[model samples]
Target: KATMGVIERNGTYEQLGSITTPTLIVVGDEDAATPYSKSERMHFAIKSSKFAVIKRAGHTATVEEPEQVNTVISKFLECCV
Candidate 1:
């Protein structure tokens, strides 16, 4: 919680936008901690990034939707490789 506050205060939008590597930003549709919209913004900031939304999941998306998460990650990695 404290770390989140510190990071929020010291937002690194500049560094985020400077990423040259391919990035996959995945978020659960029902995630209250870090909503999909926030991830969407990050996807836009990254030049080579793919954004994925896991349905019927929350903050712990990997736990709640393991298969879906794995599938998304697999697809992203396939493109990367």
Candidate 2:
């Protein structure tokens, strides 16, 4: 509840548009804590951000689908570099 409230009132949303750095936003298709829609919203907020949704994974996508997560991270890093 507290976390949700903080997320709702956080200034990050307002500052997202100002961020010019490359960002990789990854989330699981089945994530309950932070769903795909929320990730999409973040992607839209950050102009230079990339969004990746791992299939058949949950909130702990990195742990549940390490290969997919690593691949996505690697690709993002490659592009950033």
Candidate 3:
């Protein structure tokens, strides 16, 4: 399910950035694919966006550091609310 969901191309990055909706980007310091730099670029491109980095994790930081990732998500969601 996750693979299918991830594979589906909802839209191009530019289109996603063009959206007025707020965006939150979280990346691990060691991510290889969709690296932190890419997330940084995404955040910069989106007018209203926030970005965070997990200190010691890779691509699947949410799984590698659930508590830290949750913390970032919680904080970001709070800002949205």
Clashing pairs in 1: none
Clashes of each: 0, 0, 0
What local lDDT does model 1 show for residue 54? Answer: 97
Weakest lDDT window of 10 consecutive positions for candidate 3: 9-18
Error of 3 at 71 (Å): 0.4
lDDT of model number 3: 0.87
Candidate 3 residues lying further than 4 Å off, grouped into runs, are 1-11
TM-score of each model, in listed order: 0.86, 0.84, 0.80
The TM-score between candidate 2 and the true structure equals: 0.84
Winning candidate number (lDDT): 1
What TM-score would you give candidate 3 relative to the actual structure? 0.80
How far does residue 74 in candidate 1 sit from its true spot (Å)? 0.5
Question: By TM-score, how accurate is candidate 1?
Answer: 0.86
List model 3 lDDT by residue over 8-41, tens digit each: 9585776765777878889999999889778898
Q: Name the lDDT value of residue 9 in candidate 2.
A: 86
Runs with alpha carbons beyond 4 Å of true place in candidate 1: 1-9
